[model samples]
Target: MQKNSQEKDEKLLEKRFAELSRTAFQRDIITYTDFLNLNEQNILHTLPKDTLYTRVVSFGGYELAERQMAAFIPDALYLRWGKSSDPLDYTEYPFSAVRIAPLNRKFAEELTHRDYLGAILNLGIERCKTGDILTDREGAVVFLHRDMAGLVMDELTRVRHTSVKAELLSAGLIDYSPEYEEVRGTVASVRLDTLLALGFSSSRSRLTGLIEGGKVYVNGRLITSNGYQPEEGDVISVRGMGKFRYQETGGKTRKNRISVVLRRYV
Candidate 1:
């Protein structure tokens, strides 16, 4: 059943890819991915190198962060595409930022990523339609498809109890600071459970249940075995939890346990 399902998904993805490629070829415009992770990324990367779209596709998010929602575009088409007569700068990227500032800054509670996403989603926007919602102490800069910029800025008014006014941020107004803290820590093993427990501050037993329940993913593939060992530089996504990276193995401990470093995206 698993094998059959995998094959079916692959076929569906292939169909979608062909459709997008055809659309781009006929329209001569850049296209973007609705949503994609490591598994879909793997499939995309493995696409036949000889295809015309293969060499032209590029991925980016306006800011540097963990597990960014990547886009795929035709290189030539994007070079010519622009907002005005001036060609769009690749560094500027195709994403638009919707800055949400509170009406009363002092009384405004600091919103979480979930809060921001929830509010945007509450506006009837699908999760796949948007990229990442980067929040800071003062406000958040939401990366979204350029086409939806106007709609989000107009429709999104408040988050929770705090009234907010949204505006489309120019490239100069964006604050591209590091969104997460680099948590350097050691783990007893490279097993999914141990690393996840430390990353999430959860107990090993809870992590075990989560992993066995098919809630853990390594490199975008579902992992059910808690004992599954992950190599360095692997992206792990825990549904309803968060995403983290198994950076590397530092060294062995005095107790004969493995030491490792991890990046937990906050």
Candidate 2:
């Protein structure tokens, strides 16, 4: 009797697992908050570890959640809003959500801003912008929610009117120029320890160690001293950290502190 009961329980568990897997495949949006709640309740513990989760957060939101999730699941991906041309214009807030399929490539391109927003609306999730879209590493696209289908269709209709007006305004702004060009700042001098303070992977000793090991270079020459001072015209290149060019150093601030500009090279 005990053996029969155990076998029956296993079968039921397998059936439930299969159902959840199918649902996840069918859905494009999943919230981190919801995922966390389900895990806490022991609903997702048996779910396959092979599942890949992709998260979208506004610039600030990514900073809040990435560390916690990264510690436990390194494979989890986080996408944040990137910088825009207009400095005063702000991107939408409250990061969006999207799911990724394992075999899919060209992620965000597959879905557009309209399609993603439509999905969010369909889910009955309020307080989200209709212009937001989610893309993956490969630029494949997915809508945030499945419910906003009709809203998306309606939005697509008005594009012609909006695009014409936008083009006219862009044409007018093309000839505008500022009164003066902004001066490019330079890096005056950098302490050997500044790289360590800036969160480089190497320690002061390790940095010097690399320098002495002939792995560190400034410009094209290998630097032997970790304490080698970098001047305004010099470029510092660490083996793994990339290269930084020293620009003009704006003299000390009111607190009598040095200000330096380190230009990063791609």
In order of appearance, the predictions have TM-scores of 0.70, 0.28
Kindly list the per-residue Cα lDDT of model 1 for residues 86-182, writing each as its tens digit.
2235433456778888989988987898898898889888776676677777788887767777888888888998999898877666657554556
Tens-place lDDT digits, model 2, residues 132-233: 233334322222222333443333322212210001111113221112222233222356445423324345665666666656555445557655777776
The number of the candidate with the highest lDDT is 1
Give candidate 1 misplaced runs (Cα > 4 Å).
1-14, 22-29, 37-93, 172-175, 179-188, 203-205, 219-229
- Model 1, global lDDT: 0.70
Error of 2 at 193 (Å): 4.4
Error of 2 at 65 (Å): 37
